[model samples]
Each structure stands twice: as C-alpha cells, then as structure tokens.
Target: MQKLLEIKELTVSYDHEVVLNDVNLTVHKGDFLGVIGPNGGGKTSLIKAILGLVKPSKGQILFHIPQTRIGYLPQINQIDKRFPITVLDVVRSGKTDRRSFSLFAKQTEEIAHAESLLNEMGVWQLRHKAIGELSGGQMQRVFLCRSLMNRPELLILDEPDTFVDNQFESELYEKLKELNQRMAIVLVSHDVGTISYYVKTIACVARELHYHPSNIISTTQLASYNCPLQIITHGDVPHTVLGLHDKHQHDHKHDHEHDH
Candidate 1:
C-alpha cells in the first residue's frame, strides 16, 4: 500500500479561468481509483495536471516513481483519428523514445513487445488497418495496448469507456483489473454504475474535491456535494442520494447553459 502519487492543494486553470480548486488526493500501488463527475467538472483538467500536460496553477503533484514508470491513455474523444496512421503504427508510436527504428536489430525486441500487447488487447488482427476505420471500442483498445507496451507501473486513463458498448466497457474494466495486479490505475469516468465493480476506491470531483474511501458513499456525503450524484458498490447500479426530481431540475439548468 505504498503511496504512488500524491496531489496536495492542487489547482488548475485554463485561459485564466479556474477549473480545479484545492484538490488533494493520494494513490497507492495496486489501487484502482475511479474519478467521477458531470461533464465540464474539471475531471480531464485534473488528469492533465497529474500527467504534467497542464501546469497546476497552485500546489503540487508528487510522484513516487523511484522504481516505477508512468503511462497515460487520454480520452478517446480527445484523440485525433484523422491522423493517417495504422493501428500497428499507433501502438508502435508508444516506443518512440526507445532506439530508432532504422536500427532493426535493436528495435526488434520492442516491436515484438508491442505486437504482444496488441494481441493481448485482442486487436492484433486489425494491426495493419487504418486507425480511422476501426470502431470506437477497437480504437480505444489499440491505444490501451500502446499504453501497456511500456509495462507501466502506474496507468492513468481519461474516460476509458467513452463511446464503447456495455460489453466492451466490461471487457475494458476486466482487463484493467487484471493489469491492476501489477500497476496502479487512475481512471476518469462518468459511468458511475459500473466503475465500482472494478475500482477499489472513488474520488468524486466537481469545482472542489471530495474523497470517499469506500465505493459505497453515504447520503450525508452526497448531500455535502450539493449536486446530483450517486455511489456504486459491489456490482450494484448507482443509487441516488438526492431525489430524482431535484436531479432532473439540476440537469435542466445544467443543459440550458450549454445550449447558450
């Protein structure tokens, strides 16, 4: 249960607008942390801050990677499928930092490793296919394989289940759980009903931060969030801590702003 990553009073902003505020959390080895929130709730921003893709406006993200490596899989929606790349090429891209491809003898081992990861993700058959041709699930699996190619000690994923069907979502979580045996995983997901079955802990984010150790959060804690929310536990669907009418009203107001 060694701490793998720690965020202390972390804050992030975009274009001078504050997104994350005073966020604090810690991740441990073998931990599966599910980050859940409504859209535009700064979930992606927090992940970006953790990956060093976005600089925190305040505070720090400390990594205990003295003997470990970090790998990241960004949200599927954020990826540019228009790139003229093949599935194999995308997976191989994960090894760009290694020996140059011109030295075939030196890169042979890395190529084989990438192929094995692709096969493990069940996408090796589409290795030569264009990335744009694959379904959303297939594309996600391809990137997931690429992330695993490094044999990471910590894996961070942003919205790993977006655009995927239920079956593939289940498969993805199962594979992630298997991977968690060797590496800690931190995932940003909105699918509250399914995340608890696979993840060991939950971190609910909004404009602020709330930490829940158990997948089953209490009604009091949910009330403290003062927003439409629920908790999942032991394969059960999320049950609302707030009334349905209130949630619907809140959703309407939330949507109205987006329409503008």
Candidate 2:
C-alpha cells in the first residue's frame, strides 16, 4: 500500500481553454485504477499531465518512483502504423528511455524480455512482421508487449480495449488482472462494466475528477460527482445505477449487471 504517485490541485488548459481543474489523486503500489468519463471530459488530458506530456497550468504531480519506472500504452488509433517497424523492434524500443543497465547484458536481457512479453501477448510468431501489416487487434497486443518490456512499476493504458474483438477484450482484462499482482495500473476505459470487474477503484473525470474509492459505484454517486456516462450493461452482475436522461428528463434506470 505504499504510495506510487500523487496529484495535487492539478489543472490543465490549452490556449485559455481549460480541460482539467483542481484534480487530486493518489496511486499506490499494486493498485488497479479504472478511469471513466464522456468524450473530451479531460480523461486524456489528465493522463498527459501525469506523463508530463502536458504541463499543468496549476498544481503538481508527484511520483514516488523514478519516471523511468512508469510505462504507458497510448490509444492504438493514435499510432501511425506506416513507420515501417517490426513488432519485435517496437517492443525493444521501450527500453531506450533507460540506460542504466550494462550495455552487453542489457541488450541480451531486453531482447529476451521483449520476446517473453510478445509470447505472453501471443504475438511472438508475428515478431518480424511490419506493424502496418497487422490488424487492429494484433497491433494492440504488440503495443501492450512493448509497454511491459521495461518492467515498469506503474503501467498506464488509455482505452486499451478500443478496436478489438470481444475475445481479446476478455483476454486482455484477464492478463491485466495477472499483471496487477506485480505493478500498479491506471486504465482509462469507456467499458465500465468490464473494468469494474477488474479495477480495484474508480475515478470519473469530466473537466474535474471524482475519485471513487470502490469499484462498485451507485448511479446517485456518479450523478453527485457530475460524471454523466451511459452505463452499458450485460451479464449476471446486478446493481442499480441511473440511466442517462436527456433534457426531457424521463425516469429510467440502468442495471450495473456485467458479463463474467
């Protein structure tokens, strides 16, 4: 339960347009945090701030671990696949950010580690393939491998479930659960139902951040937090949250049942 990262009064703005305001959060060792919100709700902005990609206009983000120990998997669609890189090379690049290890031993160890990650992701056979030639799902798996190549203490994934099949989604979550035993994970996802089953805590971001200490959140709770998102339900898990209502304000309820 040691603290890994902490954010204090964080605010982000672009050209006078504010995206995030006064957000505070803390991550601990072996934590699995799920981030959910509507589009343009500052979810990505918050992530960028944490990764130091975007300078916060106010407040600060503190990391107990070295920045090099943090791994990031960006949204797959953001990657330009035409870069003419092999899947294996892509994963190997993950270690370029750090150079403390012995040169000779590092290359050999990193290559071996990269291969293991690829194998675990079921893409070792496609190691030599050009990234552009792979399908969306394959690309996702490869990036996932790349992110873990550094053996990071904290792994951050932004909408990792996008553009993948149901099977891969299920498999990915299972794999994440396994990975969570070793590292803290911050996952930004729209699929609340799936993440709720895996993430230990939840944070709803919408121009502001609402840190829900438990994965199980009530609709009233979401409303009170000012986070409005459509709850997509499926499966046997049962809980009652509120349904998304328009300006018309019709009374409707959403069941937080999830597929196992």
Candidate 3:
C-alpha cells in the first residue's frame, strides 16, 4: 500500500520533560491504525503531532499529500448543549471545505451533502431537532456526520465510543469498517477489546511508541514493554495448571523489544 503519513524520531515535550520520545510510525493507504496505552502516555500527543496541533521538539513528519482533508473528533467535545443548535446546523458547522459562506446564498448542494451523511448515520429524521434534545448516542452520530462532512482522507477519532450507547458502539464500528474501504483511520482509546477487533493494526504508546503489527497482543507481551495495560480478551483458553510437585514462579523477566 502507498504510504500516506510518516513520523521519524518524533519527540514532543512540555516544560522540560518529554511526553513522547523518539516516536516513529507510518500511516499507509487504507490503514486503520488503533493507538492504545495508559492515560499519562503520549497517545494524544501523537495524534496532535500528526494533526499539526502540537509542534514536535525534534524529528520530521512528512505527509504524502500536502493538503489532505482530515476529520477529527476529540475525546471531549466543547459543544454547549444548552445552546439552540439543530442537527443540520451541527453538521453544517463542520463544512470546512467550502469556498465561501453566505446564509442567504443558495447552499442546496451543501445542504444535500449534509443530509446524505445524516441519513447514512440514521439521524436524518432528526435534522431539525435541537442538539440538546437528542440522546447521547444520537448526539454522537451527529458529531460523526459532522466529522465526515469534509469527506476526509484520514479520520482521526479520540475515544469515539465514550458516551455512546453499547449498541451503537458496535454499530459505529461497523459503519467505520465500511468507510475504511476508502479512507485511512487513526483511533486512540483505552478500550482494548473492541479496538483490537476493529483496527487493522495497533500501536502501543507509552513513554515511547511501539507499533505492534497485529492486534493479538498477549498479556505477557504488554508486560515486556513495561506497558501497564489491562488485556481484555474473550474465548475459551485453558489456564495454566501446576501439579502438586510442580513449581510456578511469579517473577517474570520482560524482554525489551522495539516496535520496528
């Protein structure tokens, strides 16, 4: 696949301490990359770096396309629900690709585009409804449509499933899976279980960045990276059993490994 974004020896710092050190990764065409790690880790820093929100102290970020449309949904939204904003209005607020804006001007095309995305998200019927009146899941769908309004080449989401209902959580993933056919994705979350299943690859970010080729990371593998993450997995696996005479050691040695 063609490479879209590349980060080499990227380091982000605040004050004198380094948030991310010697971080490196590449985003390829149609790549759905999931970033998982601890709270204080530099997961958000990586995203901000890629999005050009934070200046890297050192290293280089090369974008294949000089002007790639990006859709971003942060973990915390600053939307004031108390304000009177309709679903269409919310979707319209994200149309950054337009050349000009005139309220009285003919915006039929833009309106149709927003409506189409709203319908795809199953919220077209609520287009006229106030954002404050909608449920959490419904509001999330509205934000999703807003993010998608620009038809971004890369979609960057930070814990998109935070306030969404459990049912829509899977539904949203399904939608994103279908959308991944055309665009690349980068998602940051602490939810290992669902992200492992949906994303094509996983990057475990601690003080440094470790890109795992596959999502099937063993609990031991996490410990080896000194990554303090909870591994949540499903299925029937036999637990280790020791005979009465056998000895099991609780002490484990972690192999220091690079992501490569």
Candidate achieving the largest TM-score: 2
Q: Single out the weakest 10-residue window by summed lDDT for candidate 3.
A: 237-246
- Pairs of residues clashing in candidate 2: none
lDDT of each: 0.77, 0.84, 0.78
Model number with the top lDDT: 2
lDDT of 2 by residue, 154-213 (tens): 999999989988778878889999999899999999877677767878899999999877
**For model 1, the run of ten residues with the poorest summed lDDT:** 251-260
Better of 1 and 2 by lDDT: 2
The Cα error of candidate 1 at residue 184, in Å, is: 0.4
- Assess candidate 2 and give its TM-score to the true structure: 0.90
TM-score for each predicted model, relative to the true structure: 0.84, 0.90, 0.83
What's model 3's lDDT at 126? 99
Q: After superposition, how far is residue 95 of candidate 1 from its true place, in Å?
A: 2.1
Off by over 4 Å in 1: 66-68, 96-102, 218-220, 230-260
Sorted by lDDT (best first), the order is 2, 3, 1
Instruction: List model 3 lDDT by residue over 1-260, tens digit each.
Output: 79888999999999968999999899888888888889889888888898899999999899985444788877746567888889998998888777655854537767888999999999999999999999988888889889887888888888887888778888888898888988899888887766766777778899798886664455666666666787553332111211111112122111112121
Give per-candidate clash totals. 0, 0, 0
